[model samples]
Target: MKKYFYNNIKSKALLLTLASITLFSACEKNDDLKIAPPTTISDADIFKSPARIEGLVNGIYKALKGASLYGGRFLLYQDARGEDFINVTANNYTAYEAWNNSYSSGSNDINNLWGAAYTAINNANIVIEGLAANPGVVTAQKTSEYVAEAKLVRALAYYSLIISFGQPYNKDGGASKGVPLRLKAENGPENNNLARSSVAQVYAQIIKDLNEAEAALPQNYTSNELNTTRAHTSTAIALKTRVYLTTNQWSKVIEEAVKLVPQTQAPFSTTATAVKHALQTNIANIFASDYTSVESIFSIPMSTLDSYTGQSAIAYIYNTNSEFYVNPTGILGDAQWGSTDRRRSFLRLSSGKQFFRKYAKPSPFLDYIPVIRYAEVLLNYAEAAAKTGNLVLAQNLLRAVHQRSDASYVFPAAAISTETALIETIWKERRIEFIGEGFRGPDLLRNLQPLPAKGDSNLQTPAVPLTAENYIFPAPNTELSTNKLY
Candidate 1:
């Protein structure tokens, strides 16, 4: 686990050095605290020197380990809002469940998200600034690749901010104030009063960063682990596909999806392990354990002992307290999960409340929290194909996942008959297929689709009205109070 965190530092450091170059004034302190020497180096001096340039780039990936972003908080808040689980105590997740005004400026969710995302964005900005100042430090090709990777990460951070703060940042009645745009290191007071950019401007920035990332990143990195871990050209493409699709750029969505189809390069296309990839072979293992299968395209590694236990804490809070039998509460249980599907075993009811068995053990374990996966790529292809009048292709894709799950349930011919129906079919499949993994709500709202109240059988809680306002969380009080932009 330590190895996983440390390994990426090399690349991250190199990236950070590039960013710092533009933001900081070079100054070295004198031993007697009298006169100091200028820390600034000649462009030739820094570029001619190999060691420091590499160190800064490596710093970028290290920042990802921060708890506010991928380190843990990001995935937790996202999962909390989706349809799969309801917050009973409603402690941290009250606003999400009620779809009410509970998530005001003072809400923890709002504040945490705001802080974490900017932390990531600022880190990326610093990297970009530094690289801009000393372009000659690395080969032109390598430098560009680093630049692209940094931008991709920044875009990803902003995308998270845009969606959480408000959907369609630039769209009608959107969150009037979006996330702050930090292009340089905010190391002092002048940077503190930054204001929010409009949703439109945020989206534009996101697109710009992604476009640069796609161009700069290599088709694939040489390092095996890093290839799977870090943002690549494919990651940028996949994210842009999502962003375009969300903003209703249907044509561009299809174009990006097409580019991504061949790039996913894994069990994505092969039918041999299709079921396995979707956890059809053992649904319990897929959801309940830290199984890093091929379907996982991007994720954060969280170890019990080495770092904070986000997943475990969630499991414990959601579950009930019964020693022998752990049952999920009525608010969060599938009636059929226990009887027929093996996946039900992932949670056991304890004292009438459903407790996730995945991370319930007394001891700690290694868990990798997912950021993205190949399943998304497959789904994107299906959606794009369906939009392009290739209903058969889309139907085949849905059927593949369903058929992979239960051979006994007959495939429906109606599943892929029309674009409208195909979209609905795909949405339902995603809800069931990615349950507890956190893609459901956004998947529905981003497309401007109607959501059934909690009671709709497919949605399955009790019918409740959730509106577009539910999509945009309130600005954290801290941001509103301290930052002029909000």
Candidate 2:
């Protein structure tokens, strides 16, 4: 029952000078303003040092990658909620409850994910507020970049929450209810209880934030991994493509995606920007540990020293010895892309069971959690082209992804002549290419498809339909008691 919304958590970077505060303990409307410790560092004291400001930003990133956030359950739940995995009765993993779509509003997985996402959002809110208040703490350019990064992370967290707790944006013409959009820092008790926004309104705010971020973020970084892991102008552009796609802004998707992924080479690439995000010769090696390939636009780092373990780690649940096993029978389990398709090798057989190796398990389950990727950018460009009747360019982009994986899997032009066919091809490739990386549930929802039915006779969770109620998880019971708006 720990309240992560205002928990006093710490990261490796002990900027405790800014730590040790729980914002909502009183639960009284007036007390909500009391976000910091009674004698916490003053704004002047903390903001005078650039290191402290950076530490606050670092803390936000750490919260974003928490076990309940992207660190584990958020992505893991999305994958399980999709139709790719087999829900065998014998495989009674407690975590699979999300995969089965049978969990209640009281479920810990649902509640924790809800709380953790908001916590990350709150962290970003604090950074945004701090940076804005102390305009003279850093150079104009540095301040712009840092504040831009905070906005980028906050936008991402909001989008993730909207996806998990609201209906698809395309459904009902974007009129569906979205989760509470917490933008301002809740440092005081100023009527903080707010109702949900419309899905359309949320997207509008997200777009506003991303546009600001894209304009302010640095165009280049000194190091490759640093560029891949942190927010930058290209990251904002790449993420915009995804946001546009989900909101069904076809033309906008093409416009933003083309900036990152070109028809022949990676876009947003130049001697100045240095975003060389084209496919590597071998797609199989893209997920190699400690290596940041040209295709990784933005990812959260994980390693031996900073890796997820126990049930919260994605690799832990996907392990054959654990509650799940790779299915060997469906189009998902055994799709015949080509004999030489590199992705076909992504699934591995261990201890008499096939396991998904897409995230690329290190000795201790620490594959980087990708948020937006170059491969996805490419697909976004292709899908947008297909949707807008630019069939030739669409096919070229789609074929580029296919050949990158197999090198010889030639996609015939006539096979995907119609827009529907080409779009389907791109979607299928996205599903296969990102297997176990957590796109299955989202893909299904965006496409308005039914959740994969229970593959086991003994399990009794019914098939999930394309209803708004089923699409969004209910507000967690914790919120009901704590959040006045609920």
Candidate 3:
């Protein structure tokens, strides 16, 4: 989990350096003497060797683990924007602006997140282009796998950016403007003036990349660790389920989901060809020491040497320092979430305040940040089944996720008697299961639901309606300052 070469670049100037081919020279006075080794390697040299090429591929994953991206802040900001959590410290360095729904184009979180995501995207683009330019550097099969891996990472990064900066696709059928789509490698400032694409256009590219990646990616890696951390066939299919779910493509969701998740019964899992992903018998094991569990479809690996610093870790913000705590009157107050439910084990009370313990790691906070899980895929399939008039299959899918945590709890007859009630029950299960995992904001926006308000005596924020300007994050000032077309 060591930080790769790409993590050192922190600003836009350094970001543009990704495509630069640095050269070294020595003075004539030292012509007779041996020249010192060059400090930087050219991008061309990197793709000439298999090891260096693999390093470039790993760099894409490293970029996603930045604190402002998926590592912590992205998850923290998404949860803070929802109603399930109340700000404890109101610390600006944390997600205060996001919790209050008051962030503007100039906000630090907005700019940093936008920068980090695009940095990852650019790194992926460089890998794809560099590998293609240098053919026969590796076997054709290995080359295809490497390029497909990069495409998957690029697709994930674009999906994150479009959902954050642009309006939800379900709102206007993706007719509104989305983030700028950068496909080629940007070695200089010439491409900085590219205009934003439509939301539908972005999604179409995302699906296209995913489909290509799915066809080329390996069914499974050699080990459990690689299977959980790297892009594979199941990984791409699991993500498609989520993307299709967001766009309200029910049949597409079901079509993509069943590739990985079998539709049979309670113990749902993939076949031996793909990674064996199933719900952990105990809900807590996924967050504990066993990070390489089959349940994790894909996650950003973290370790003591390469982990979030200061308050950037999710554990520090929610568990250690207590910057935010669970909202009593929010989802936790729902009577349907029984007191005896095993999922309640994730909740902890300290000094009369309840906080989420899903990210329970201490100090360096070496918990792997989950990008997608099997439970989520199951729930996504369940929702899609319910929407497409397959209630029997939907109920079976819902029961698999629910009973895995609480074996004795039963869905009341009224709860599953109708299509509407069953769908509502599935939604509630998602909120409880993914409370601190960053699905809250996306869940609200995908359905065009308003962001509900929540606070204590210290602060009170209003609900942001669908028509409000703050419903979605604005394009960052950094992009506007450089991209003239924006």
Candidate 4:
């Protein structure tokens, strides 16, 4: 897979350069390139045809596959930064630096994330330019829709950077400093010395892209299961819900989620059959050999045999020595996971430390790491409704997700009666439901909630309040060196 990636870089950059446009290929070799003599494909010719446009759009998805967002590295960055997953395991020790401490300078994972996400943004910008220059490239409805999909992904990549490295859009940190914005297809001296835009501006771009994306995207591309690979209207809406909540745009959160829920999609919501949440009920099924689970809205494809490079966070959680596997016990016990539950089988050990088996692959193939899921949408609605004083609606949504996890369990009527309790319950369910996934850090940061100390195993224990200032991660040294923005 790495070789395939390398070859694509060589060809695409050459093709784009020959086509007379600034190239931003993520797979492109990280070396200096001199603009060569022009060839057959002109800037006019590149986007004038549908094939070229399709190729450019395909690059957007390909860039997204860069190690920063997926390809193993992003997974580690997310875990190391979150309250879950301690680096007791020696795997990827540098990653533990960023997770445990917000201010990391020379961390490779941090550096890689900044570079890769920027590369994706550049590719998106190139495509948007092409679409504008050559409107004829997408005459058909499907092609046009795909163009919108590209915009959504581009927005997503930028938002990832903003939330992690900077601050929420409406906060003081956001106003003070943010990451640089690259919205053109230029590869010259002029590209240097650009300053960081305020988080407000960055979010403005994100919103613009998503607003257009929501309009162009389909209701659901291929149902909840298969839709994990593709972007749809609901994913965009759900993402917006998160973005707005981060920026304290409560009205927007409520508005976006309302638009999303009524879509009434499967896996997105279960039937009364009590089988709705059964998909992830086994716990182990969430990380099964099958990547296309019913709950995953979108994920990075990891192959055990070929594509498995190993995620740093997963490696740290499960200590993997040559002869034996070590698991660090975090929240679950062996009995809690149960021998029958696949998650427990893979993630738990009788030895004091419990390691996660979900991401464990002896071969090169890794499990499909989820980026978005239907479960998040449910949680989003529950939180938004609870915040808006809609306790009944929020409780029902919370119960919908919780009931799916353990079908036999029931919530007392009084427990569901109040807004605060229901909100807290929904939050707890989110912590459990999305553990080991990347959402915890952002979820905590966005809600202005506190990070749990190592001692707070019982999630119900009260947490010290965290603020928006805690949301901004210090810019890595590499970025600071290249662009004095930090």
Candidate 5:
């Protein structure tokens, strides 16, 4: 509650200028100071107390809450840019452009996203450096956990950046250019001119950091601020499934997902205390204004206590809309299940007005932004296992997620008789399951699939191939101009 530093990128950037040393985390908004690294409290003075260090770490989560990052806008951008949500405002031309798959490197949304991610990555680096130095105060366990958390935060940022900015790792062995991998916590003019890492290198670093994170983090933390809001072993494993899925590491994806999600129990939470990672019965309640449920592996905490403002908020997207419309197309319309699924309870069709009920307001803007969930982990395993010739295991995993949302739903053996069919079935399930959750587009990109016909009108020029030049977001023009390497 009331975290200071992470709220805005300006203050985080100011810290870097003041320190003349490395700044940590970077997921704040700063249209003016483009390409600046993330920051924390003054190193020597702030480290005298453990509470300060804790708050600094808390700041990392706060920074991530930037509307441009996870607070809400990122989800909106992903979904709107994909096939689900349509931009109906007509006046918001940039959004329509995005829907049409034509956003440029100079696009404000692209720049905003690029800045937010680097801010988080840098902030994570700052934390890692501070924890390693120890400041001669915090306990060993605390230090290790903090360092691991930093790595996790950093990995999430880097992975997001790589996938969004460069080609998917499965494309040509990840030979494309990725955003700069700034690992060290140092501040110098030269540090600002860093080079892009190869997509493969970025993935390797993400895996390495995640491994350190998984090893150091505890099984669970009792509070939402610690467990759900922060990283834990299960959180790391959950992320590995996402990472491997994107990189096309079929075996590794199943392996990591299986580590946390049980093959038999299906939707059970793993930790002993506070029911850390189990699936809750009610599907609607998970997206309500209250704190996250057992299925929440990692999420950014948002609520009436800490409300989101501006266009980025979920409340703005679904609730206050003359701008965007909740429209699920492509795979959903193709898969007959979307019409009858029980999870459609999350949607509302009143007086011909349709919008998702997940962040509906009377509750205003209090949804705890989901980063990943048990359902996704199961789906990831299902996809990976199917690809790896484990049809039985794949069917079981897919059904676990399916049955949770629609009790009447069942997968027949003929539905997934072959490995190709199983993979296709699981992929379609993801399209329905994650609708409006900003995953549909990335799901297409990573799978090397085509765009589902970009929202009818602006894309009338013969649907752009998913392989178009601007398919993935380009690196921010600001970063390209600032760096000598470009």
Candidate 6:
């Protein structure tokens, strides 16, 4: 992880120097004039200019899109671990190990993912510390906002790491060992020997970061693109709902959710000052050409010039070649997911196989990957409502999501007759709503449920019980080899 901090600093410094040279070349017209760029830039120099500071801030977000992290593999690995998809190709380069629950500490998948997440975390830490040390690089307001943005990114990275590498908070109230908590910036190997913090400790820090971020983040950005792609006050609150839900803080989920989802009925929308978010009237519209829909609370923006390549593209793995297909015996087999439901439209059939179509951009897939959606906030609130015995609001919230996808469909009496049944329905709705978006594994683990077995006799994978060693990913060998205290 410290290696990542070192590399990021050097690379970003080079980028800043090159940018400065380009700007100078554009403005200077003296034919004989020459300017020598610095061979090396200190950390202080990187934060000396507003443009340089902004570049570092953007780099923190760029780190989140690493191929092994949110670019594609993280979502693919999570869904593969669930029962929804069957692996058509048993290639380990993909998520075959995750699908079969066979990954070890030395596995490339675990190591790469661990490295990617920590790289993002460390980068955010660097920006946070750098900005603090040089307070006037930007306006006090801009400085606070930048630091808040870094905190939000760091909090998210830590949350992702904890859920993947540590036991479920519900399982032991977060008593299990978690990945090392690296709060301070480290630019060299000197600080590589850190011990793991308990899962509870990590959660506490995540919450602390989020609370501070929410306090300082803007209510919304000037444009829809920025609102969907960057951190905002609503984004922080939305994420808090998810974090609180995973920790089974039922009331806390409600508390945070209502901040964005203030309405008590259908067509629920956020009361944010500039960026008003509500469920898209047409569920398919969110995944269509326009990915900047208000429904998208936060998403990783991708373009032809900057997007996942090769097998790392979500469309390539799930749709283009059908590496994984919807399991006939899994959620696709759920009778409740009626054929008339509009969400079923996301499924495609070619050469006698069913594939997901949410990410349908061909070749160089440029589809924006959703990080969180307003729909998720509604459902998160609904689940918490049911868990807290507010079945009426829970049923109403569940109906909002269900009816949005299938307006004509009505819930059977038995499905919503009790609180437990309503909660179960909400979970099922989540699986259907977020099939290719990567909420399956985390949802199951948060509930302490087993990762159900899938596949036919030819490529069957066994069920991973909650107590299984592979239930949560092992700490990668990369960290174990470097961190002596680990």
Which model scores highest in lDDT?
6
Each model's TM-score, in the order given? Answer: 0.74, 0.87, 0.92, 0.77, 0.87, 0.93
Clashing residue pairs found in predicted model 3: none
Per-residue alpha-carbon lDDT of model 5 for 13-56, expressed as tens digits? Answer: 33533222222222232111122244444556555677567656
Residue lDDT tens for model 3, 32-63:
11223434555546778776676667667777
| Candidate models: Cα lDDT each | 0.55, 0.70, 0.82, 0.59, 0.69, 0.83
Name the regions of candidate 6 deviating beyond 4 angstroms. 1-40
Q: Candidate 2: worst 10 consecutive residues by lDDT?
A: 24-33
| TM-score (C-alpha) between model 6 and the true structure | 0.93
Winner on lDDT (1 vs 6): 6
RMSD, one per candidate, in order: 9.2, 6.8, 6.8, 7.4, 5.7, 5.1
Number of clashing pairs per prediction, in order: 52, 3, 0, 18, 12, 0
- The list of candidate 1 runs beyond 4 A from truth reads 1-55, 93-101, 169-177, 262-293, 303-306, 310-345, 349-354, 357-365, 449-471
Candidate 2 lDDT by residue in tens digits, 92-174: 23366776676677878777887777777777877787788888888888988878888888888888888778888877777
TM-score-best of 1 and 6: 6
Judge candidate 1 at residue 52 and give its lDDT.
Answer: 54
lDDT of 4 by residue, 1-486 (tens): 011111112222323543333222211221111233665565556677665575566566656767557555565565555555554433334454444454455666666777678767777777766676666557757666766777888888888898778755554646756777777764443354578888888988899888998788766543434355566666677678777877877678878766646533323453321112223555556676555565665666543222434344343334343211222343343222333323345555535555555565554445566776667767777787778887767776776665565555566666567877677667667755676666666766666556654422322222334463434566766666655434
Decreasing lDDT order of the candidates: 6, 3, 2, 5, 4, 1
Instruction: Give the clashing residue pairs of candidate 2, or none.
Output: 33-187, 33-188, 33-189
Distance (Å) between predicted and true CA of 469, model 6? 0.5
